[model samples]
Target: MSVAARIAGPDLHETSVAPRSRSRMLALVIALAFAAVGGQLVRLAWQNEDASTIRVSMMSSPANTLARPDIVDRNGRLLATDVQMPSLYADPLLIQDADEAAERLVRLFPQIDVRELRQSLADKSRRFVWVRRGLSPAMAQRVHNLGIPGLLFVDEIRRTYPAGRLGGHILGRVDIDNRGTGGIERYIDEIGASEAAVGARLSARAPVRLSLDLGVMHALDEELAGAMVRYEAAGAAGLVMDVLTGEVVASVSRPGVDPAVYEDALDPSRIDRIAAGTYELGSIMKLVTVAMALEMGRSLDSMVDTAEPLKAGRFTIEDLHPLGRPMSVSEVFIHSSNVGAGQLALSAGAATQKAFLQKLGLWSALKTEVSSGPAPQKPQQIGRIEQITLSFGHGLATTPLQFAAASAALMNGGTRVTPTFMALDGEAPVVRGERVVSARTSALLREVMRRNVTDPAGTGRRADVPGFEVGGKTGTAEMAAKGGYRKKSVLASFIGTFPSSEPRYVTLILLFEPKGQDVTGGEITAGRNAAPTTARIIERIAPLLGVPAKSL
Candidate 1:
């Protein structure tokens, strides 16, 4: 201080103020100016900072998109669930070198077009752009390591199927925003399950429980898949249902689709055959015809002549192995005689046949939680030919699901049963529908069905599980084509009920276009393939269904 005062002249220091006071004031003014200049520089730096290094949250981006709830089987087994995943996005305004960023990203994702991405990133008007969606954790980490500017990640919920393709047609699929699009997934949305939930967080509601038993479903799936390979069949479909409650415990269609793969569901060849398509069910329709005969005061032992082939215009209806004698009604069912069934239909008249079919619910479409199947294709009028063919499962096409529902009613003691996919909650009583037949008629039908499995010459003899007492009908019909029926191609199917004395469950197995095999005695009949397949399925699923194997 003394040196500074000496250097400054004494006259200058003493003129207006003390040297120490003036020096302090000057230092304070300088400090204030520097502080203002430092703040401006810091502000400019922040505005120009590299956005790639910064993390931007898109929490409120898809605010209206609500997460879906878990879909579980009857035993609380997981089928479908929501999982948190990081989806990639970009802020175009923050992208400094758009060309460089796009080029780097294209290397990681070969599917992305670099030029299109470049244009998207170069547009400063849009603050956000989608880079990629539904990225796996490993995939997200790989993209993060690239260190591209403007690229960011947002947490979102995506639907995941745990069992892969199992129950795909039943569980359905979701959209990009996690909204239900088809199957039971869409049913959830229709019931307002996601109405109140409008965020990325998953639905807090208790999981949706289906009537399907995972163990039984797996058994059915495996058996059907094996059947397809064993029989050299083009496709296969099967279902197991609780006859009393009308609950479809298991439904599977081969060449099964995966819910995660949207394209698979859209494929026509991969459609759910159980409930999605209608087919001329061949001999299975005789179940309805025989039920009509029983309901019309005809005894099981009543004889109907099948000595001559049925002639209708240009068509001649006959049995594959005609007995060439007057056959009893019970024999008519056991043999699956087309001429016999046609006679029963003619005796009852065409009007009676149509009414019985309509009463059985086979004359219309059957809508389940899975799908509203195409309406049954039937003749416009019930002429002699139409009535004869309809009686023996031709000139009329209905879904296997609809036919199953009708059969369940017959097996469940005369009461109508509407097939359902939803589980009956709690100790809810099994509400029975209107009686479609007399209890006496139901008992007679049961007696004959039992004979069909036990009798040596029965068409369904191959379908008998040792202790399950399976009774069913076999069908092998030439597949219909543009002009007429395809001679060699057939839809082989068997529909049976277990513990036939008092039926509990109904099983329907279908094998489409099965080829002749040595094990089948070089025959492509339902008894050779579909019947034995049904037997195998019954043996496997009966234990899971709580239907204990009875002592032979």
Candidate 2:
């Protein structure tokens, strides 16, 4: 072959190999590009699924929180408010060593259970776990200094009671997530006065104005605390309410619960005495009997034979200080004669007596802004024996709040008064309740109540405060125990009305298991304990309540 032909053939063979190599390299590059695109799509889909799972878990674990408006007294003083606090959480999956994490956390917060925390952290499946909630600024700072990798903090709204233990029963308590559990706090939720919160959002609604006068409440609390110490009592409760408007001015129950410490509220001894507890309040029931008598057209001077002990089925009711002579209706109240009250109750038949009490809202359950007061326990059958026993408050049990409202009806010119914790808005329309008694009967009842305080022989004379026109009735009821009444453990109470001529407010003071002291002349009667307490309370709160002192 010629040399030129051989060279051209070699060059053509090299050209064909170069074109095939270029085609193969192009296809390989395209295939790699398609593979990269597919990998990116798969990674994105996995990430999205993971995010969706987290979102679903978050939604399912409901974070219960409430955005509540400020609770203020009638004077616009803040009682309860929401404050921002740091809440701690941890990413369990991110924790490298759960034992070390839990140990460090427990050192910072001794209250934390180390074992539970360690178990929670070891659960790598769990992404989140609550470490602590409602941490104070100082506490949160200490936790931050720990430098734990998985630990984190989020701002949360927390309930704070500025008044501490003052009016605790009225203000009530909230849960860890800030949802109200009881008292006025729960009422706020029930009435739609609060909103669900997301994050640290605050309520934009107007503050809830309560009928409570902060000044009055503080004074009442101070006085009741002093009384508890002075009388050596197990517990004490007191309340002041507007007779005409039925607005609770001040109320206190001791051993008061601190709203900040939620556990204190659950204690049985710390229960709200003014509304939550029922007691057979002894001679205080005489107020209802006397009112019933007056409603039946009996005059204050009407006489009833209280010389003999009242007999019931296997029971005998006798006065502590029997007059031995017949007592006039007014004298019976002044002397607190249980037999006379029984006679009066019998005069008004069982049906009429029950009907009268029901009319006064004392024979059934009562609901206020604070709570649905326990239903009054009455005899299943209002037989002759039951009627006689109920006349002097031995067989019937009612809350002081219910009885106070009923008494207010008798003093507020016979209008039915429904007690309220919310402040009444003057601009808002008021739906007045039905009248419970004749105005004439109410007038006579007021006169008798005043006489019970002013007369020298009256059991409530100690309750009379100078210039305040304080008029009240004393009650000393034996406390009921496991099966029967404990004679020595008496509940002393005073139901008082100030400026009896006008009767603007009613105050009730109670001392449970008060001991006889030198100041009380070794007497456990309400006249020695609760009556004086009422006088002190009235003198201090009347001025704050805008009740002017009158000339004697």
Minimal lDDT window, size 10, model 2:
1-10
Clashing pairs in 2: none
Q: Which candidate is the best by lDDT?
A: 2
Instruction: Give lDDT for model 1.
Output: 0.89
**Candidate 2's residue-wise lDDT over 373-411, tens digit each?**
899888899988888878888888999999999999999
- Give Cα-based local distance difference scores for all models: 0.89, 0.90
Task: Output the worst ten-in-a-row residue range by lDDT, candidate 1.
Answer: 50-59
Return the TM-score for candidate 1, rounded to 2 decimals: 0.88
lDDT of 1 by residue, 1-552 (tens): 545655676766464566577788789999999999999899778875554333232335545565677889999999999888888999999999999999889888898988999999999999999998888999999888988878999877889999999999889899988888999999989887764333457778889899999999999999998998998999999999999899999999989999999899989999899988899999989989999999999999999989999999999998999999999999999999999999999999988899989988999888887777689999999999998999999989999999999999888899999988989874988899999988878888888888888899998899988888888998898899999999789999999998898899999999999999989999999989999999999999999989978898
